[model samples]
Target: MGVCGMLRVVQTGIGGLDVYDVQTCPVPKPAIGEILIRTEFAGINYLDVLMRRGEYTSTPKLPFTPGCGIVGTVVELGSSVNGQSGFAVGDRVVVLTQSGGYSQYVTADARAATHVPEGVPSDKAVCCVSSYVAAHQLLHRAARVHGGWRVLVHSAAGGVGTALTQLARIAGCAVYGTASAGKHDTVRGLGAVPIDYRSSDFVVEMSRNEPDGIDAVFDPIGGEHWLRSRRVVRRGGIVVGYGMRTIRTAARMLVASRGRRFSYYSMNTRNVLQNTEDLRLILNLCSENIIDPVIGPRLPLERVHDAHRLLTDGAITGKALLDCR
Candidate 1:
């Protein structure tokens, strides 16, 4: 390894955490229109777990990097990139890598990066990249949530789940979230009524609490859970499915959503403009102290496996960041 060498986590094969391999490789150069970033933090998303397990339909081929979002400082700009791109070397930014974010250095198109606001930390800005962006899109773009509307969020203690809860509350929506009993306080602290999904049935519970049904349901746990979420929504209300933890669950959710007001959301590079706008708004929110991302653990890059293990075990209460510095 030389001065340009960097460490990255690679998924050599599909399976469990054992598939993650830490390797030292030459830092990748920024291609034309790209910017090389010295990564400060990388977000660990549940989608990474799906890709590592070979469960996601969109999972990349094996031996690829596993992370999708990062916050870092621009170190070098590629040829053809200039001032109009809204980026400069030494500027901190948050960008969606889609893959290859799990490294000490990563490159992204300068056009796709969002400037991190002053007063916001790199760890928190990275959280806004993928999870918070998705959460914002799901609430405002997909669900079109309105103040005073009652909404339900599944897996309320996880990354996107916690984001949804906090943002929904900020939007003036009455929120209800389902998580294990241990996380009830976390959901409750976010101003949402917490329902313990383990011991009690959410359908029965929501129906009992709001007999009129809720306005929207943001569900990531798929399959029969989608059907259950649908049953609790009021007429004309929507069930938005954002993640499929299992392939079978996604398939079952699709079959169950037929003839219903069900919507699905998945962020892609094609939505970079919209995503960047949303990311900027979120970073401002963080800067103003209006809303803060519920940060969980901060693990070093070498502890990538331990980070993933904690996330997969559902032990993390909020977004977890990999300290790439």
Candidate 2:
């Protein structure tokens, strides 16, 4: 509040990062179709961690703040930005941003934000962008899952995984999920049949259970997992690949080998090209309620490095959050 300053978590141009304090850039003034928000919570995503490590495809120039979405109260509104954007000063809103969310204040294009319904916690609304939207898109759009279908979701206890499982069940599909052994029960509790990804060949197990194979596979892990995913789906069944956790794993291994031969650019480009529809479908699903994101551990803005380490290490389930305020 002093001098209208805002605190933000910024990348320091190093591989992994530590926080730096910058006086709030002059409080962003709203232009037409824009609104200023005092952010209450920001969603931390795997993409953020990847960006911090210089591994994500869409890395921002260094010394930038990292946060993708926010749940906040509108503090100022520009002329021509009102009911059409569905917000006004004092309105509770959730905004999606490519970056710049880990701050005390944000200026958003009104069209890109949603008003949070009464009774929804700010923390929960933060999940709508990354987790819920991803889940909704994967099941309803990419996979075209419907009643009577059988679906398989990987990392079932995690954010997108859990959302997909719940949404699939709501849509009357039989849901199966793969996770670490320790998370199987949690997956099952969410109405998914849990498969232990570590101890089992999921493709073989799924085939044995469904016999006809599953109608779709929602996978964020690529690399060798895609081979198995292809096998688990019935003929023409869709495999929606959103993240490349497997590729990241492989990349890390390649970093350790002096003569490792592979082009990160080529591989990532191919991966993105192949998954364009999948991402489009994810976006569509968010406009509807087929999937709802599961919020995970919430950390303060300054501890973003710890958040990244937790995500990379898979130490936490679901999506991690940054309470920017």
Candidate 3:
């Protein structure tokens, strides 16, 4: 148990926000090469909601706590900890908690934790571990985008979309993004040409603008969305995906091939922590004020279910964070 005594957490016996039950329990202990953190804030992600609904790629055992990213202060460390964690007690850090991050405290594998640079708010830092990292990877790693390259980002006002748009802009890329009409201004302000997914067909709009095709397209909305995105990429361009894609879409992905590329980027622990160079660049970007997360709403930990509802239902415009403090 942590020095603080009992821990308060919200969990679900089954997969679904409707099934969440708050409970008080013993704080967990850190294992070898781990640190116990008092979670100050946790990022709410679409994957968390999908995991709860049994729709995500993987599901945790019953009665699991679901939180993907956490920013907090380290209070305790386990045996054999050394230079790798680079941590001291009270050090603020952001860790990618694949699951079990919703609690007041969570133990993280030291390798997965990145210390929050001083002055960056925990709210924005939380976005770094999930959405921001995905955006950076999609542009620099997956698509290998460069200056003047044109890219399309679907859901341009959501967490990953906002991050991807801004980062691509930073890379000197021409970004065409899709969002609801209500968020067109937001998308434009972030340096993307906003296409309304509601009224206009994005594929038709994109083709009209760049008939020859764009350098790359980033999509999270699957199904027919992929079909439309596939039609708009240039002959040698790539279509990058990062959301819960449907297996049934494989045939469509193949049909839309036409010598273009389509690849899904999984937001797993390996993908998150393996690319230290990108992660360092992200931190430097945040630290130097080159990139800023578009944090949408802040809610207390108890209101996590509401946060999930808003995010999954397309009500959230940017990243939503839970104030665990």
Candidate 4:
């Protein structure tokens, strides 16, 4: 603890998550147009890992905290916080903190923070802030998929993949998802035709079946995987790369071996920013039981290392949550 009142936080002075250490820092004060939040849970994502590793396109400076989305209670209101926005003390809200979310408390812009709908748990609501919105934008904004369209989704068992599959199905599209053989059934349950990428070549399987190719391909696996993904799309079809796990892998390997430099920065999430309409739609869907967040595991704050490892290794299905409270 510090001499002054402070909060416990997980911070990284170096580029890797291995450098993460606990420290007591003065609790941040909410500034104008901001709200102080007591973090109940923080949503971890591939972006968090990239940000931590200093490989992401937009990363924080050194000695930083890395977490993308957070669900918490508004503890204090900033002076310029407008009452017309409907935010109040004690309201349960979700904030999309591009950084500084891996902590006991965080401050967020009032306009960007949204109240969680009743009945949605903090763990799941956390996904809606980024993961669900990512899927939403990929399908609707990037691809403009329509009813009866044939869509392909990579990593179909993961958070954004599951969201993409379900959203495509809801849009009346026929989804073809690529995943490991073990996750085939789970992908099928999400209303997608599962392609076993481990045992079979997805490009050949998809291309041979659909001679015209697919309407859209949502690939989080960048690098060579991105090249394959682009091939599965028709001339006019779209290929949207959200997370570049594969590209980041090669970049890490290059750095470790002191080899040629590689960049996976092009596949970051700048294209899938915040959308108020999509947030409202997601929350409404949760309330009506139309769309549900598929959570993989809930790890305590201390298990953050395990959480990141599990996500990086593809050892778990669905979204992972960090229990900060």
Question: Which lDDT values do the candidates have, in the order given?
Answer: 0.88, 0.70, 0.81, 0.77
Which whole-number lDDT from 0 to 100 does residue 229 have in model 3? 82
Candidate 2: count the clashes.
1
For residue 111, give model 1's deviation from the true position in Å.
0.8
**Ranking 2 against 4 by lDDT, winner:** 4
**lDDT (Cα) of model 2:** 0.70
lDDT over C-alpha atoms for residue 121 of model 1: 82
Per-model clash counts, in order, read 0, 1, 2, 0
Evaluate model 2: give its TM-score: 0.81
lDDT of 1 by residue, 1-325 (tens): 1358999999999998889999999998889999999999999999999888877888887789989999999998999888888788899988886799999999898888888888998888888888888999999999999999999999999999999999999999999999999998899999999999889999999999999888899989777778888888887888998888844456444534534478887887567878878888998999999888889999999999899989888899999989999
**Candidate 1 ranges with C-alpha deviation above 4 Å:** 247-260
Candidates arranged by TM-score, highest first: 1, 3, 4, 2
Against the hidden reference, what TM-scores do the models get?
0.95, 0.81, 0.93, 0.87
Evaluate model 4: give its TM-score.
Answer: 0.87
Per-residue C-alpha lDDT of model 3 across residues 1-325, encoded as one tens digit per residue:
3265544455555556668766777778889989989998888887777677776757777777888888999988888776555887889988876787777888988778888888888888888878888898888878899999999999899988999999999999999989999888899899899999789888889989999999899887666667678888989888887775344254345634788887877766665446445666677789889998889888887787788788867888989888887
Tens digits of per-residue lDDT, candidate 4, 1-47, equal 12234344455554655777767677788899899888888887888
Candidates sorted on lDDT, descending: 1, 3, 4, 2
Best by lDDT: 1
